[model samples]
Target: MITDPQGTILALFLAFCRMGGCVMMLPGFGSGRLPPQIRLFAAVAISMGVLPVLWDLIYPKASAPGATYIALIFTETLIGIVYGLIARLYTLGMQFAGTILAMSIGFTAPGGHDVVEDATENALTNLLTLTGLLLLFMMDFHHVVLRALVESYAATPVGAVIDSQKMLITLTDTLRASTMIMLRLASPFLIYGLMFNVAIGLVNKLAPQIPIFFISTPFLIMGGLFLMYLSIAALVRQYADGFAPIFTSF
Candidate 1:
């Protein structure tokens, strides 16, 4: 039953190019905390699993040997990166929202190591980002992303020339949509911070000798923490819910 070993291997590698590219930038799987070996093996395993399902669609195109095959490799990898970035942008938006939330609420504690990346981040921002990502994992976001990758082959068939313009548009749209959602999530904090700071400023102007601004720091942090306690569950739940529509629509 076996024949064309070379073709099969070639097809598998092609499949790997896409799946690996996607995994390289996927949210939970792509976190810097994860060792590269683990990610590599995970990608390899996923590619192996997917290759069988896509063998018919991919093998024919893959069997051809020439400069065209090299082009195909680049095209497939680009498509995968595009798909991964769609999900990545949403998660990055959460980080952005967290940073804004921290700054607004005066919760800018000394930066600690980020749970997901190499950079240092404020404690509150780290908490928010970690909680949001964990919730997404609990909700099985990876399954949705994998399913999307499979569906992508249908929307953008194997060996189709990459559409640079469309790819750019899709990425831009993702950034726009994610930013709007993150801003909405962080809006309450933004408003609260603005009003609180304004009141503090007014008091400072009225009673210039009291050192009111310095005095308010503890209260600001306490109130912000209390507000976060009251609303964080809903914030994360909404963040998780927002992902499905964005990923599925694209």
Candidate 2:
């Protein structure tokens, strides 16, 4: 029943090359904390699962083992990496928003190990990053990304000549969109910080004898925290809502 064993194996490996590349850059799955062995096994499993569906598309090209086959492996992996990076960029935008929120709200605690990644982040950043990622998981964002990956094979195929220029443009566009969304998420804090500082400055001018900066620190932080408490639900909801449009566009 198992005919063309070598061809089957070669096709499986071809599938692995693309999937492994994607997994290497996926957000939670590709975190530095995850063991390389686990990532390898995951890619292999995904490849095996998808191979049957893609066999007609892959096996014909793969059965001919030669220099061209090696080239196909390289191109397939690149295509997958590009797709993975698109999602990775969007998630990283959440971290950027967290950092902005921390600074704007004066929650500048010393950096500690990130809850999910090895990178050092302050408590607020860690909290927001973890919260946003948790929301993504709750919304089954990984499933959306995997669906995109599976659909990508039909678009890019196994051995098509990849347009490096187009790939670069797509990444740049994602960065732009992600930057805008993060800014929107952090805008309220930005405005609060600005207005609070301006009012503090005016108060200091009115009473030169009073150390307004020292007196205002607690109020500034308190007001920011209270505002965050009020708006956090909407903030993250907007964040989650924005992901779909951005990802689908690309």
Candidate 3:
């Protein structure tokens, strides 16, 4: 059963190269808050678990003489990074949308500790990002990603030629799709802010002597907060729903 210990170990490492690349860039797994040891172990475990299913595909390639094996390592790692970035870009897009929403509604609170990342984020943005991530986890989005990883072997085999153009196109398409979705989600607040500001401007023009700027600040923040409160549920719901279609499309 263990006749080919060397080959098996090599194959497992090759698998790890790919899976680890993905985990290195994958959102939750790669988050700065999670320990490196945990991510490393998770990648190793996933590679080992999937090895049997992919043995036929990986074992032979892992046997390549020195130069080829090294090349295969790079190729596999790049492919995995591409797959991970597809999902990463989508989440980053949501964060972008959140920032826009925050600005539109006048929630300019100072950046604080991010719930997910080690960096700073506005309170409103942090709320949106955390809530959206929680919803995605509750709906099992990671399962979808894991399924995609398994299916990717067929789409991109162990030693296949890495197509830079195709990968670039895939990333470009993901961004385009994600941008459109985020823009759609954030548009309502954008419009609301524009209209509110325009009306306020007109009022200012009519009553130039009044301290309109100071007076309108409170109203702007209050209105934005109220609107966000009313729509937060729907916003996060739509964000979680959009992930599958965008990810699966490419």
Candidate 4:
């Protein structure tokens, strides 16, 4: 066992701590409403699983523990956090799209549920986020994420120079891209919502007594839900397609 060697176990534990921390904050696994204990267990399990395979290539020398070792561990942890953030940013696209769609359809409620972390997001936002998460798992995106984590060790080694500037640039670019993609995803709903509201407004103006707003509510909800159902497969496909280019970019 790697731990059998003196000081090796300590280094390995430090490595696992970094890996586990990152996983504890990763997109799918970290986002859900799971117990903290379970999440920690998962992180430990994953780190232990990967350590053996990756130890030789990524393991830093365990000799002469000092400031250099501490610095290297810190750097390694930062690298893991960066990798984790990439996936998290990608997952945030759904939240952005949901927010857009919610606002467009008059579902923008400040009922605390309109946010995922603090409380709850809007119903539409929650739906979108959950749907996106489901799609991620269904499409095996987590598998891709693990592969990327392994690949990251190759791309950015332990104790090596971490291009912080490059990491910042990459994160900013990814965030911008994610925003654009979210807008694109919600574009159809935006257009539809806009056009529908405009037409409804005109109808209300022409026939002031018709209660057009009341009548249209059912239609809008039904149509919106149906459209979501119809486009779900395409949406998932787009997400899957978008996910692939990111690993290579890093």
TM-score of every prediction relative to native: 0.98, 0.96, 0.98, 0.85
Worst 10 residues of 3 by lDDT: 61-70
Quick one: how many clashes does candidate 1 have? 0
Candidate 1 residue-wise lDDT, 15-118, digit = tens: 99999999999987888999999999999999999998988899999887689889989999999899999999999998899999988889877898988988
**lDDT, model 4, position 248:** 54
User: Candidate 3 lDDT, tens digit per residue, 19-58?
Assistant: 9888888888889999999999999999999999999999
List per-prediction Cα lDDT, in the order shown.
Answer: 0.91, 0.87, 0.90, 0.74
Task: Evaluate model 4: give its lDDT.
Answer: 0.74
Question: By how many angstroms RMSD does model 3 differ from the true structure?
Answer: 1.0
Please state the error at residue 233 of candidate 1 in Å.
0.1
Model 2 segments beyond 4 Å from truth? none
Candidate 4 per-residue lDDT, tens place, 16-90, comes to 766775786677677556667887888777777887788775455544577887787778778778777888898
Worst 10 residues of 4 by lDDT: 109-118
Question: Model 3 off-target regions past 4 Å?
Answer: none
* By lDDT: ranked, best first: 1, 3, 2, 4
Over all chains combined, what TM-score does candidate 1 have?
0.98
